[model samples]
Target chain A: MRSHQTVVDSRLRRRRTAETVFRFFLLASVILVSLILSIIVVSILWKSLPALKLSMIFKTPGTGYYLGKRGGILNAIVGSIEISFGATLIALMIALPIVIYLNTYLKKKSFLSEIIRLFLDVLWGIPSIVYGVFGFLLMLMCHLRASLLAGMLTIALVELPILSRAMDETIRLVPNELKEASYSLGATRWQTARHVVLRQALPGLITSTLIALGRGLGDGASVLFTAGYTDRITTSLLQPVATLPLAIFFQLNSPFPEVQQRAFASAAILTLLILFISLLTRFLGRKLSRHRIK
Target chain B: MDKGRVLKKEKGRLVAAGLISFFPIFLTIAIFLLLLIKAFPLLSLKSLPDLIFSSAWQPQKGQFGLWPFILGTIWVTATAFILAAPLSILTALYISDYASVRLKKWLAPVLDLLAGLPSVIYGMWGTLLIVPLVGKFLAPLFGTYSSGYSILTAGIVLAVMILPTIVNVSVEVLSAVPAELKEAALSLGATRFEVVRYVVLKKSLSGVAAACVLGLSRAFGETIAVLMVVGNVPVAPVSLFSPAYPLPALLANNYGEMLSIPGYESALNLAAIILLLIVIIFSLVARLYLARLSRRRDR
Candidate 1:
């Protein structure tokens, strides 16, 4: 009896130890994650504090953007927004029909569906540098240098998989029964899908689109090559322009302390934008959870 | 089976329509078609070894060795995997086997949020926090200047970045473990730790390995954050404090300028193609394995 009780006690004690370890790890993850985000915010703010003067925002870089009075990121900022929005608009226009077709037409796991899925997975994995290079090369053949339109197309390629997948998943969540019910009421397949399926998946579809937006904005590598950083903002969609992420990148590498500080400010703005979108989607994710529950 | 049989009545239009359904697949093809055509000049059966194994990357001298960047990517990814893998696995084990509902409710979302946080933001944080922290505390002891970027710092930041992904994948695997298996282990007088280590972990190691590999790939191709914090030197170095460059960073940094030259431009395009190949292979293998696992679960 004594030996048995000792064994039982040891087992219980071991379980307790495991629980304690688990608790510690969980707490550590929380702290680590929060600390990471905090550092990003704090560092950007700290770096940007000295560089936030009005002159820094309005002028162009001279001598060095940071060292002299002419260094302003206005062109890059405008360029970034233009490219991002343009890419977003273009990618969505393409991805929406694809998603609808996949969910509505390819309802089962046929060979075609499987192939499409595999291709998408591969597309998602393709490096952004590849996209940048490819876009640059193709454009060069057409007598085009790295331009805003080229950059937008490059980013559009990157975001399409993310958007398509999200759109597909959201569309899939639209119950077949609802579609069938709609079909029984004498509606065509597209009409049934349009009215019932899309309505249910709106939130998720929106979330996916937002994810693509975030990816496009955060991406530096693909943009650096295709956009060809320029200080002057232009109205033509085909003209060269700079984006904020690339601006931060160039400024970070600059020898001038002032330019580096401006880089930090840009970094701050970019991080805040990313965080806001992530947090917002999460708030909208409540609808997603509700969808999952069904 | 029955659904297919019933559906086959309309097989003519249904199948053709189904085939036509993925017309968006053209997007994927367009991506590949354009990439291959652009980077085709880089694919030489002659310079294959030079491209893959040579340590030098000076395109001016006609040296196209990618070994340095590849090695750097591998090293940092391995370091990050070593740091995050164990912690993530244990967290998953606990979450799947022991954590209560309320705790999961709180913790799961936090982990999800971790996954969602952008790499750029992570880079910003690393440049500010990890760089100084390492420069101040770690560099002096190692007889080096922190220079605010190191493989060690990059690895640490990447470890954190990928931890949630590892944890999420592992938790999914662990949650799918059969209750009967656990019950049988307990009936045989296995302790909780023993059951998890011997039964749960052993059974799920493949899935965990897959998760780790996937995370490693993410770490390998990671840009922005790694670029910001890494010293961005092209040469290999033994000390963690010494700056190093990986292929992804080098490609992004140099591709623009290199485009001005012709053969040199093709060489750079080739490098980009290689990067794309790596990502596709890694993703496809992982996805196939995952898809198989899910299929098994359904059965």
Candidate 2:
């Protein structure tokens, strides 16, 4: 009896030690990932701060921007905003209808919805560079030059899946009882979707659109071939436009240290835009959730 | 009430909505068609197998072999998976099974932020940080001339970029493990780790598999970040320290200049088609597995 008890106690001790060690190992990995992210953000800020001039934020890229001369990424910044906003609007037009169709037209477990979801998933996973290639092909077929319009169209393709999926997920979460109530009141499917469901899914729709816009703004690959970079700011959709991501890419590739610093500054600005959009979603999501029916 | 007019309007709305919804399906088909049409030149450039099998990628000579790019992509993606999978799984386990409530809350927002970060930012980080670090430290150990731009550097950056996807998905999977299941395991005198290892993991295996597949898909499709640091050499990687060119990098770097050459556009389009098909397949598989998981939950 004494020997059996001692054996059991030793085994328990071993197991306990194993558990403790394993737990700490897992914790360490998690911490390491977070630390890496923090390090990246901090290093970007550090590299960017010294080069971030007040004039750089507002002035357009000059001829010698790549040669470490004085200029700003304002051309790129305006182009980024113009194209992303255009893309967001384009994606919203297509995505909102699809999301509405998914919720209103199809039953929850329908095979058709499943197929559509799979299609969206596939699109969502496509590399942005592939979209760039496709956009280039489209440009060839149309005999169109690389322009802001092409960038907007390509970004719309990139943003479509993400925004649609987000909206679909949120719309799917609307309580069944609400829809049933609308039906009992003799409302048509379109009416329910337009009036009741739209009201409920508004915040989510805005959040998803902003998120997609933010993604489009930051993507460099999709615009690489479609939007030829320009030094001066142009509002014409037909004209070639510079964008922040491309600006960062070009400047970083420069051998000059000052140009590299400017690259970091552009990156810092891009990151700030994304972070701001994120914070907006969180704030808006919380405030709007109060009005959401449980 | 004019019931006929109301019915007519409802039918019109339904038709409009249905047509609009058809846009995604139409877009998918159009893209596939367009890709094939654009790549037909390469496909008919002898045979598909010859183009893919040959090792050289000289567009000028009309010898458009993609084996090196394919191999580079596979090597970098595989290396990234090897580096990321264990760390992500462990992190997911910890978050789902061991972390306190407060820790979970804190971790969630951090992961969200990481996920929301742009790939361009990641590329800049990799270029400024990982590439130099590799040249200064890692390459010398491998006895390679340290250019700092290699498959390994890109792999490390890719691993970091995909971590949030893996961890977030795995956390969702593990969290979906029923509380009752864990309680039953504990009641039977199983240790905490044992319960998690046997019960929680077993239940969430499919979901975890989906997470890994999705992460792999994301890593494979990523372009700019990998392009910035992967050296852009059009050769198969013989070692981690060797420069390599993945397909996306090849497309991004050469598409502009290649367009001026005959048959080059077709070759790049072929590469893009290959990328699209592989990514789509991986995503479909992941979604299929996730669908099974959700159905199981419903049951």
| Model 1 lDDT, residue A134, Cα | 66
Per-residue CA lDDT of candidate 2, range A189-253, in tens?
Answer: 98899999988888887788877988898889999999999988977999999999999999898
Compose the digit string of candidate 1's lDDT tens values, residues A19-129: 567567755755565566456566667777776766655655555455644567777667767888889888897777667667777646777677887777777777666
The docking quality of candidate 2, as DockQ, is: 0.76
RMSD of each: 5.0, 1.5
Candidates' lDDT values, in order?
Answer: 0.74, 0.88
- Each model: TM-score of chain B? 0.86, 0.96
Model 2 residue B8 lDDT score:
94
Q: Cα RMSD (Å) between model 2 and the true structure?
A: 1.5
DockQ of each: 0.34, 0.76
